[model samples]
Target: MDPSQQKHFAVVDYVIFAVLLAASVAIGLYHALTGGRQRTTREFLMADRSMGCLPVSLSLIASFQSAVAIIGVPAEIYSNGTQYWFLGCAYILGLLIPAHVFIPVLYRLQLSSAYQYLELRFSKPVRVCGTLTFIFQMVIYMGVCVYTPAFALNAVTGFELWAAVLATGLVCTVYTTMGGLKAVIWTDVFQTLVMFAGQLAVIVVGVQQSGGLSEVWRKVQDGDRIAGLDLNPDPTERHTFWTLAVGGVFLMLSLYGVNQAQVQRYLSARSEKEAVRSCYMVFPSLQLALALSCVMGLVMFARYCGEDHHTSFLATSKKDAVVIFFVMDMLQGLPGLPGLFIACLFSAALSTISSALNSLATVTMEDLIKPYFPTMTESRATYLSKALAMSYGLLCLAMSYLTHLMGDSVLQVALKIFGMVGGPILGVFCLGLFFPCANSTGALAGLGTGLAVIFWVGLGSIVTRSSGSTPLPSSCVANRLAGNSTVILQAVYSNVTLSRPSGLKRFYSLSYMWYSGFSCSAVILMGLIVSFLTGPLKEEDVTPGTVYPLMGKLLCFLPEHLKKKLCCVTPLGQTISACQRQPPHQKENNGEAFHRNEELDSCLPEEVSLPLVEQETFV
Candidate 1:
């Protein structure tokens, strides 16, 4: 709390921070002037679907890799040891499935909004439900993303919290409104670099200050900061291999698979191959991001593990602000370093906020608005899209105020929001894409059930303040205390076993990591049950290119005839033969605008209308 402990930025630091915001706006202005002058919904929302793999890949990572991860990951590792690092294991299956499975299905659909697939595969109401669910998820998440950096800075450097929030929101709004998706992607590319540089600077300096890598490693090892694979299978165990790796796959699917933000990037790619490649590219970069944050936590542990300075700040600090406190402490006297890190924090925030605003605009225009006003002029539509982006950006600033009341770690809060809301959204997509028999009624029922269950679990965990398990006390802190070894062991035993919740509380104690997996499973299970009860959809009635043949492939040993009867009535990627037999009147009524376009027939079903945005033929 002392003024002496506060970090003060030099003039160079301010200049660096200013450049980040200024450069972001400049990119927006540049994009606004070129690229059709942001005049069409396609250019504004889909980047004209002309992006290559590189920028799309970087933007994909930046979508969810916000200040929440920047500050939260290190603090998590510091407090809980490196057990969380095992989540990297999830990225393998997480990204691969999206690349090969999700990308192929969604990309071929040529959707402007991811929810459009829901309408094609299910019904219009289902599509609207999915859009609304996504809106709810991102609006809440934008709050955390925008508020995290500002909150952290305020705690350590006396930065004005609300002022920072407004600045971030306004700048992000301006750029997102002006430049649209292109600006959002380009800014993401540039901001991603700044994010890496800032974290690298802190890690490089922290390692040097902590007596270099070897000494730092020795300290962390001695302090028991390096965790081994905890192959615990208990659902209540928070950071076990199963919880993080297994459950984390579902979390990744929720983010990278069905979330509109990432899906928009996948759709914006020049081709399906480019989109898939970008998903693959995300793997290495994501691992690197995780490693950097984890290593920073180790460096922090080495420097301050048992020190009184660590104890003093922690006692007075909000748990989420620990990383900022450490960063400011380490970079205090360095001329431009403090500013660079601040820029890094805001870069992460702005990139995420910008992506969110643009995606929100895209979905609102494509899914919610244009569908109703099919005849809306392109110019008016583009203007409305910009207005939506600006509106959401301002709403995000308001949501940040609500975030101030929450007491959870920023990282946990963000992930919880993803799992609780995103899980159901992912579930609905999975039901529509993989279950040929799933009907609109079933999709609606399953989504409703998944959201209800996940919210109950998520809210209960918060109210009870138990994420099913607590981090074991740090050995560094333990070693410094004067205590009998047996007594300490007994105390830990009591905390782990005796303090465990029971019955309903035990249900609430389910690990937050399992939220997405658990809720997604509920949706699938409920969907199938309801579908069969409501007269399962005939596979022949399903849209082309929507079903992924997951069941058929998984049961490949079955006879071909049996596979068709059990898995699906038609082969994957096959257009409905019935479409060709339909009368001209029927075809027109069903919105079969692409029936004459043979190249599009493979993905475009007879039932769905053309997307409001331009549908270019993929090479």
Candidate 2:
């Protein structure tokens, strides 16, 4: 395998790839041309709230499963071992919390944007702050999403990077802007299948080419690529059981629980039950996605275990480029196979960016623009949404250039964005939902403090890495043909050292996995302390529908006397106490305490209108 030999795509490969792009465009055209109810803002932004659970479920999975995961996860497994797979553990509480806690509140409220809950619960300022934070997070993330696949493919296959970038970015923007949520969801469904098919094809072919499953497993085991549970309590130790499982919970919550990309899908479901069911469907699909990528990494390790391929190509490429190189190398004779894999990569990237563009347009129209222009016509609002989508699409192209300058692995960069920016936003939502005493002042304070702390730590870690920290020893030294090369084996053994980092550097060097958990905790703690100091929100001041019902039950565990101290009487002639004292009949109808009082309904702003279905009930 000469490194200089360029990988060429066959005519068949081009056709296969073209079909994927064409199918995406076709779906967009289908939605765009059929303009009955979809001409309105409601249908354009949220599919008229008529989406089924299946498409929404698949779209939710596609929202987060970007090319970063498809390529970066394998690279992580290949270089650092399979310890990163523990992220699966976090999905348990992750999906459950979103389904049970987030869905009911957000769905029942029937708001266009998830951040709109901030206005209902806290204040207009808090809502604006939340929307702005989300916009920043997604805009930055869209850059990474759009850049990763093109960057990797260019490194290995001589694909024009900027051309690929323009193709994906322009294609996604056009579809999302024209067809809106329906187009995004259906294209995601189509792309998700393509993504799975491509990965599955590569893995199956790679496994057969390398040997059997047992042979690959044996090779991985022999190379020490298999990892066990790392139960270490140290936060600085990266990819430990606690970090992936415990810390990952917060990461998942930030992405799934509060992120508008996912919340928009939840809101699009036809019913609350359908929304929850869609979340449940993500578990198996996501787990399968994780498993497929992990297996592909192990197989690549098996095939190239004793080869110095990194020296051949990886020296000039990103860590993620290694996966593309392996795929190209393995599928060399199989013409259409390479194209399928490349299509898979772009599919992952396109699904994610499309979702981001659509969701960004959604937040802009619903949270930012619509509020200012309350009397704007639906047609004008829909047009503005499309324009916003195009603007973000162009902005994404610019950010993709910035992503080229990034130094870390794509997985770490994406995760860092989720933690550094998303953690504080999640904290704000948590403050409103779980802690009734938190005020808008406390929410704003916590968010600012959280962002500052995370930026300090995140930036410090980047500095530490740039300052020549210890690097992982490469396993590429061994000779594949000779079974084992003693000299290269010795080099691998000698690279291991027992050095430890010290002081503030040690804290900054803490695992990137802990960033979300650490920042979320900091925000929550700071929010509670600031609220208590600056006069906590009264029971009457807290909005009814904004808080989760589970918070009340969780508070029931407190001592009876303590419950009495915390509970308060409301103007509705019902005791609005943390304690459960009222008879079943005396409780608010259907457990909807917020809607029982006409005064509370009056307090809701005129601009904060419910969906048509909910309006009939409320009116």
Best by TM-score: 1
Model 1 gets an lDDT of 0.83
What is the TM-score of each predicted model, taking all chains together?
Answer: 0.91, 0.87
**Per-residue lDDT of candidate 1, residues 436-520 (tens digit):** 8887778999999999998998888877877834454544533455778899888889887987789888898898888999899
lDDT of 2 by residue, 320-345 (tens): 88899989889989989999988898
Error of 1 at 231 (Å): 1.2
Query: For each candidate, what is the lDDT?
Result: 0.83, 0.79
- Per-model C-alpha RMSD: 4.9, 6.7
**Count of clashing pairs, candidate 1:** 0
Model 1 clash pairs are none
- On a 0 to 1 TM-score scale, where does candidate 1 land against the true structure? 0.91
Best by lDDT: 1
Which runs of model 1 end up more than 4 angstroms from their true locations? 405-415, 468-495, 575-619
lDDT of 1 at 169: 95
